[model samples]
Target: MDIRFDGKVAIVTGAARGIGYVCAEMLVESGAKVAIVDILADTLAEAVETLGKKGTVKGYQLDLTKVEDIAPTVSKIREEMGEIDVLIQVAGILAGNPAEKITVAEWDKVMNVNSRSVFFMMQAVTGQSMIPRKSGSIVNFASIAGIRGMKEPLCSAHYSASKGAVVQLTQQGAVEWAKHDIRVNAVAPGGVLTNAMKSAPPEMLKNAIEPIPLKRLSKPEDIAAGVCFLASDVAANMITGQTLIIDGGGAVVGV
Candidate 1:
């Protein structure tokens, strides 16, 4: 299928690196004018520069932790990139403390960044752009940890909770926005092979990857492909309020 986003404008969060960066690159290559959003100004610049060569791309530095910043930043994006046709919320944080050990502050921080901000950004974008046009696509980041919980040296109770919320948020958005022609979905990645994983202890990495039916970690591009498919009208016009699990078949083994 010729999956192209010829005239679409996409806003991707956490585009400074990892899954978000790959998603932005793919969208641009597919012909969308993409506005990359991240808090890391320097890295965001590098991403824009790298992807700019492929197609129309720009960067905006916005801290998702602060929910207050979501609307204005989205307005700025619409002003600059035109009405948003797609929104991929890949911006998230990880808190690895055990459930009992996790402090209230830590819990709030994780929830704010991983779940709350995603909703507000979607609300802002939908209100300002998508709702008016009555057409758009929204893809969010959920996680296997959220579904099955984490069981490794690093405790991810808070992260799991936040991602669980993200799954529900995506579903709620899809249900409420369907009449407006906005499709909402999510991508759940497991043990992705990113820079962060490369620095992890060998044992930790092994424990993480051994159970996968594929016997491998997911690449950033692997997750990006799911995001792009959900964002592409030609590919996912009828898909909404669902999650595509890109976990190297880890879910099949109940990992």
Candidate 2:
């Protein structure tokens, strides 16, 4: 299907690299004027420069952890990018620690970025733009880790917990915001071959892939395709409160 977002305005967080960057690139290619938000100033600038070649694209450098600043930053995006039509919450962090070895500080760090930032960003975008217009689509980035436990070297209790919160948050937003004509959903990706994954030891990468029904890690584009579908108002209009699993059938085999 040829999906398009011509003339729409979108906000994509954590869009400097990996799956986030690919989503921003695809959105621009589809003709949406995009506001790519990230905490990495240098990388954000580079992303804007590259994506600008395709279509209208801008970058906003803001730390999502500072929840207080989200509203104002979103307001600025509105002033600059026009009324936001879609929001792709793709910014998140991951850590690996056994449940018993996890620290409070580590837990807080992951939750702040992955869970807290997601809720507040949704609130800021929905209230400032979508609710007033009574129209919008939101796609939150969740993980397979949130839905199932992992074996050693990949397990992190706090990371899983934060993603679980995201799944719930997406559902809550969908139920509460449906009356306003907004659709909220999530994309749970598993074992994507991002730069971080590519850098892992060969054995570790192999171990990660062996459990998949499709014995290969997902490309960033694979996840981006699912995200764009969920973020498309025309494509996913009737879909809400759903979590689309883009895991190469890993979930099917209990991976």
Candidate 3:
């Protein structure tokens, strides 16, 4: 299917690198005017510069953990890029510590970025743009860790909890906003081979890939394809409150 955004505008958070970056690039390639957001200013600038060559792309450097900053940032994007037609919340963090040893600060940090900010961003964007317009699509980043427990060394209780929150949030948002023609869904990925995963300890990487039926880690493009499908109004018009798992069949084997 040749999905296209044409004249739409999209906001993609955590788009400085990894799966987030690929999603933003695909949106641009599909003809959407994209606002790529990230806390990493330098990296975001580079991404903006590179994506600019392909289509209309802009970078916004804002820390999603700062809940207070979300509303204003959304407002700026609306004013600069036009009312957002699509939102892809991909900003998240994974800190691995045993549940028993997890500090309050560490737990809070993960939740703040992965769960809380996601809610507020949706609230701000929908209230200010989509709700008023009565049309939009949102895709949140969930994880396989959220869907099921993992025995991997890097799986942290807080990270899993945060993603679980995301899954619930996506469902609630989908139901609540369906009246306004807004669709909310999530993509749960397992062991994606992004830059961070590339630098992971050999044992950790091996552990991640061993259980998948496909016996391979997902590429960033793999997850991006799912995200773009969810974000497409035409393609996913009837899809909502769903968590599309792009785990290379790991979930099927109970990994």
Compare the candidates by TM-score and give the number of the best one. 2
RMSD of 3: 1.0
lDDT of 2 by residue, 77-191 (tens): 9998899999999999989999999989999999999999999999999999999999999999889999899878889999999999999999999999999999999999999
The order by descending TM-score is 2, 3, 1
TM-score of 3: 0.98
Task: State residue 245's C-alpha deviation in candidate 1, in Å.
Answer: 1.0
Global lDDT of each candidate: 0.91, 0.94, 0.94
- Go through the candidates in order and give the clash count of each: 0, 0, 0
Worst 10 residues of 1 by lDDT: 146-155
Backbone clash tally (model 1): 0
Candidates 1 and 3, the one with greater TM-score: 3
Q: How well does candidate 1 score on lDDT at residue 40? A: 98
